[model samples]
Target: MCAHYESPRDKALLKKHFAINLPSELAKRDVWPGYQSTFIRRHENADVGDDAVPPREALLGSFGLIPHWSKDDKIARHTYNARSETVAEKPSFRDAWQRAQHCIIPAQAIFEPDWRSGKAVPTRITLANGEPMGLAGLWARWRSPAGETVHSFTMLTINADEHPFMRNFHKPQDEKRSVVILPPDLYDDWLQAGPGESGVFLRAWAADELQAL
Candidate 1:
């Protein structure tokens, strides 16, 4: 479910790779669902017309998704991940997906549980080349009861039963699944993709690209 991850890279690296400023508060070693983290998305500026390019910006948002119609924040705990197969139809993610509110979550590594030992053991997974990677996500904007706007996001996941590496985690009896980690070249395309075309990029990442630590 990708409940936790590390984003310890420096701001300079984030800017160099994603071309956006990293918020000071998000410059931390670890990020968890329901916590404020950095995400990259396109935003329309008032001065720019619809025909102009929407500026790509890195902004702070909670890791779990909060639908625009959500009455409270309690639902966030279970909406941190949206299954790719059902994301377009799921109540929690349907609106964001239909509206094309896509985003990229930059991270150095992700933590998961290894159940081979009979007891769950925490394991860290990172790129085989030790580089940062981007997880495909959906973002939402909700108006709080206090009239403040709250932004949140959720990672997109897919069945990974056939994956060589990803299938090793989680409970043995549970369906194996993994989050979609986009390649560097697809970052811009994913962020700009329409709802109909977004499915093309939701497959599992190559097993060779990851290393368990």
Candidate 2:
């Protein structure tokens, strides 16, 4: 599960890559579970008659997904990553998954623990081409006790025990997992996919296309 990562600082890169315009500055460079960041989702007017609205829109939201039933924001720390296999049944993720509230988290890179050297060392992973990554995620809207609407998101992960590269992370006894990094061409398709079609896009990314340092 990805708990920490670098959100793309260059708005132009986000615009050029994700094709969404952020009206305000990003919340942070480094993002943790409850930290504020940006996510791209299909615009509500995307399929409507509003030609003025873009197909995609970027919004600032918490890194972790906060379910509607959550009483407070603390749930974020534990819901940062949703396991793909159990996402549909997990109370914290099922609603978002069933609703197909898909989103793309724009990240410069993701960090993982490299434990092969006996001690844990943080390793940075990025695309081989050095462009920003579009991490697959689910978003949800929660209404706080104060009547404020809060938006949060969680990255979707897949088991990586058999993956040639991702299997290298985490402890030997622990289950190896990796966040799903979607290909650029499928960005729109993923956002538009319904509950049934969403499952097909949850597979692990190609190892050769990534670089770990």
Candidate 3:
């Protein structure tokens, strides 16, 4: 699974690619499990017939999802990636998955460990076309003890044991996994999909579309 990634930093690029304008001040480009970053999702009021509201909106959220039942934000450290096989049954991810709180994590690249040699080496992976990646994820809201509302999200991952390119990542003995990289055409379909329809969009990306460096 991806534990680190480079979030897109160019405002124009984000606007042009995702169709949302972010704040002048942006989160750190390098995102980690508990770090804050931008994610795109369907606007809450999109169906309310409000012409003023755009269909999609961008917001800053924790990279790791913080479930509503959590006592604190520390749970983020372990909830950063939700396995697709158990996402609907996992306590930390079930609520969001069941509710279809889908989101898109725009990234320039994701880092994974290459264990081809005797030791681990960090490798960067990106789309072969060099465009930003719209990774499929789930978002959730949590209320802090201080009465503040926090937003968080987690990337959805699928088994990559049989994948041509992704099977080469991670430890040789470990079960290979890869994040779901959504195609541009399916962005709206993913965000609007219902719980029962999720299976339609959770397939692995084409290996030939990605390159690792």
CA lDDT, candidate 3, residue 95: 94
- Comparing 1 with 3 on TM-score, the higher-scoring candidate is 3
**What is the number of backbone collisions in each predicted candidate, taken in the order shown?**
0, 0, 0
lDDT per residue as tens, model 3, 1-213? 999999998899999998886855687889999999999999998999988988888999999999999999999999999999999999999999999999999999999999999689999999999999999999999999999999999999999999999999999999999999998989989999999998778888899999998
**Model 1 segments beyond 4 Å from truth?**
46-54
Residue-level lDDT of model 1, residues 1-213, one tens digit each, is 789989756777888878776676764678877888888887646237764554577778888999989998777888989999899899999999998999999989999898978878899999998778899999999999999998899999999888999999999998888988999888888888998899999988889989999
Q: Specify the poorest-scoring 10-residue window by lDDT in model 3.
A: 18-27
lDDT value, residue 110 of candidate 3:
97
Please identify which of the two predictions, 1 or 3, would achieve the higher lDDT against the true structure.
Answer: 3
1-213, model 2: which lDDT tens digit per residue? 789999989877889999998958686988999999999999988988788999999998898999999999999999999999999999999999999999999999999998899788899999999999999999999999999999999999999999989988888889999999999999999999999999899888889988998
Residue pairs of candidate 3 with colliding backbone atoms = none
TM-scores of the models, in the given order?
A: 0.93, 0.98, 0.98
Cα error, residue 114 of model 1, in Å, equals: 1.0
- In model 1, what are the clashing residue pairs, if there are any? none
The superposed Cα distance between candidate 1 and the true structure at residue 59, in angstroms, equals 0.7
